[model samples]
Target: MATKPDIVTLEALDAFDALIDARSPSEYAEDHLPGAVSCPVLDDDQRRLVGTLYKQRGPFEARRIGGVWVARNIARHVEAWMQDKPAHWRPLVYCWRGGQRSGSFVLWLRQIGWAAAQLQGGYKAYRRWVVQQLAELPPRLAWRVLAGPTGSGKTRLLHALAAAGAQVLDLEGLARHRGSILGAWPDGQPQPSQKAFDTALVAALRRLDPARPVWVEAESRKIGLVQLPEALHQALQQAPRVQLQVPFEARLALVLQDYAWLGRDPQALARRLQALRGLQPGEVLQRWQVWARQGRLPELFADLMTRHYDPLYQRHLRADDARATMLVLPGLDEATLAQAAAQLLAGGLARVGS
Candidate 1:
């Protein structure tokens, strides 16, 4: 008979070679541990059916039926997914709350001579730790907030900073968004669930060194659909600010390049721009839509920036007066941003917390 399956806590997460999330596919899709592979003991349909049976029939009846399905599914996983896993391979397994699904999977693997273990409290425990870390981690690190108007290439510059070996927290990247009214990725890519975003944000923070200041983009509390934790928002609000000043022509060019996909579907682009209807005059919106249909990108973007984005950004700039140190760049070219990144790293901004 197999011995009681080993149970590991969140603190010992790194000890395992692989993480197997044994929850249903839908549950796994909503959120799972970073780098975890989904190995559900019950799929979505089976889980729903089991839940219905539990409610309509009774707990005992539901378990009697669910057990056979769960066992067969686990067997299938062992044959198909575990075919190549060596006898010495170790995997950390977890379901919703370290319950029967994961426990049974671990027992089977352990009996096969693999050193498999179940998380003490499963994904639920990891999620709680994520929430706690999101609250605790940001305040401990020194942050350099890069502030700029839309189209100023803040994200691009952040990428350059990372390439230049600076510590950078890319909140937009974590959210899988550009953080704008038109932020959704091209081809309709969806953002991760809020739980998943928190998981990624906490994992990113854990990888950084507190000794070095982390450079991050200035943002509102919300990025696309994900909300920044209160502590992180407060930390960013209180952090040192570095403002980017790129000429309007350069900013326009940067925006057009970044949002080139907008030109392909004029009707869709026009509909998206309608989010600014109240901010822009009706006639101006109509004209912009016309330009969009005509594929007149330069006119469309220039007018959008001057009439919509710039005015809003000016108000924000006024509020931020006396708080930001300016870093003026003639353009947002790769070479230019790379040079600016090097200057910041080799000079003043790099000296802030050092």
Candidate 2:
């Protein structure tokens, strides 16, 4: 006899063989549980059709059409994604709010003799958990803010720290943005939604050890489209800092290498540059576009630093007295960065200056 499977909570995720999401395709693309697989009961068009029916015709008509779609889709999913599963294989399924879609999917799986369960409160519940984690988790761990200018390789050093077995939380990487107007990807790759960014941030924090300090960049209140949770932003502010200072020319070279994509599409680059219009003098902006047109990236980059980024850094990122350590690197090449990283890790501000 097929038995009814027990319902599970979000906390039970680890015990399940697989976590399946039964929302529409568009829903899954925005964000889902960190590892949940997409098994939409109704695809994007089907979902819209059902909603339109519910709004235009009546609940009964919508159900009649939706039920057929759900049934056929679930049948295909079980046969394709779950056919080889052992009889004892257990899976947890969820939809938007533990409603009809997940309920029906679980019922069918149970009938097939698989120990499947539906999540209580579904994706909404998981999202709540992520939000709570963000509000609480940052306070639980010590933080080390890696402070630097726009092109000081702060992101590079964070990765290096992690590779050296130090803990890291790469907020920019999580946001899919580099945290500047010029920071977006060259081909117009979009940043993550706010909720998507929160989920990713929580997942990253969960992997870290509480006893160790987390190193992060000196980001502003926001990183592109997503703002750091209020408490986490506070934590970034209060953390001890490791300040890195490099000459303007070195940073200019570094910025050029990092943003070589500007040359590929000068028009897009010019538009992004224009965004600095009010702050940059009209003559400077005109000169920037001219150099960009001529592919004079080096001079343009140098002017941007001396003219734009440098003033901003001095006003904002510079610490008056609490500099934990300072490094004036001659250059930001790999070897020099590695040496500087070693110095920071070694916990000694041995007064290195080129």
Candidate 3:
């Protein structure tokens, strides 16, 4: 009395109860369905041997060998799947292209009396959909840029706006760099590839309501090693900018607070300070190095902001002729920043004339 559930497309699978990518672990790790968890039907070594057999002996022999491995794998997965399943759970399972691998899993789930569907065209099809979505995002979304000087807490403000019911796409958070030499996190994870960045941006854009403004930080076309997609870069260039201005003392305090943990590692802090060499002459660089070594972190931070960061910001501001509405926060305290951001959201400040 068992019947196969209808297969679903990637779009429909997006709304399904659970997404299961039944590819090998290595394949899932490299790239996969956006929110999918891997439940590989082939271990790494078996997958490699199967692939080799396919290339050398053709599909028939490969399938024969793969079938044996897959049968055993499915028996193991059935136990694991049962452990994961709730009585009401329905899962959309996918493999490379809704081929034998996914088909076999789908059949097994049905035999077990679970409601499961395969993804039509599978992971390859899903990737193609992601690519198409990224290619078409610019004309479909309303974007707003949050522009500010270094240490102005633009990232923090974006999160605040999101909490206040604003749609937000946090680029720096996605790229995992704060967009500066000193911006690296202490843990220092590298940013995703440019391809991955675009994929993530498109994913975020897809979730946002086009009618509501999606706030993003004003960044250079590149964030660390990753470059923004041309359409996204252009969109950012054209979006209206909300510039945040805090007092120099407040800015310095914010920077110190943000980087306080780095103070313990003077050598590392000095190396980060040294990254500013190109912006300053030999003398200024040497002076900063000495200050860094001497643990004069506050003085070092102040000089870098005034001499290097502020000037760079000024140059960009002049070049862009940006329509900036300044949100002046008296201090960088969370309470003050949150209030100022709320006022900006309420349109409560003077606009900078172009």
The best candidate in terms of lDDT: 1
Query: lDDT for each of the candidates?
Result: 0.88, 0.85, 0.79
The local lDDT score (0 to 100) that residue 196 gets in candidate 2 is 88
Candidate 2's error at 93, in angstroms?
0.5
* Candidate 3 residue-wise lDDT, 171-231, digit = tens: 8888888788777766667777655666677778888888877888899978887777777
Tens-digit lDDT string for candidate 2 (1-354):
533446778767899999999999989988999889999999999999999999999999999999999999999998887888999999899999998989999999999998889998989999888889999999998998888787888988787777777888999888888888788855778998888888889889989899987888888988888899988999888888878777767788889988998888877778779988899889999999888878889988888888788788778854552555675677777777777667778885744434
Ordered from best to worst TM-score, the candidate numbers read 2, 1, 3
Off by over 4 Å in 3: 1-6, 56-61, 83-89, 189-199, 269-294, 318-322, 351-354
lDDT of 1: 0.88
Clashing residue pairs in candidate 2, if any? Answer: none
Off by over 4 Å in 1: 1-5, 318-320, 348-354
RMSD of each: 3.5, 2.6, 4.1
lDDT of 1 by residue, 1-354 (tens): 543449978877888889999999999999999899988889999999999999999999889999999899989988887889887789999999999989999998888989999998888888889999999999999999888898888999899999999999999989988888888888888999999999989989999999998999988889999999999999999898888888898999988888999888988888888888887889998999899888899999898888877787778664655667878888888888888888888765422212
| Local error of candidate 3 at residue 223 (angstroms) | 2.3
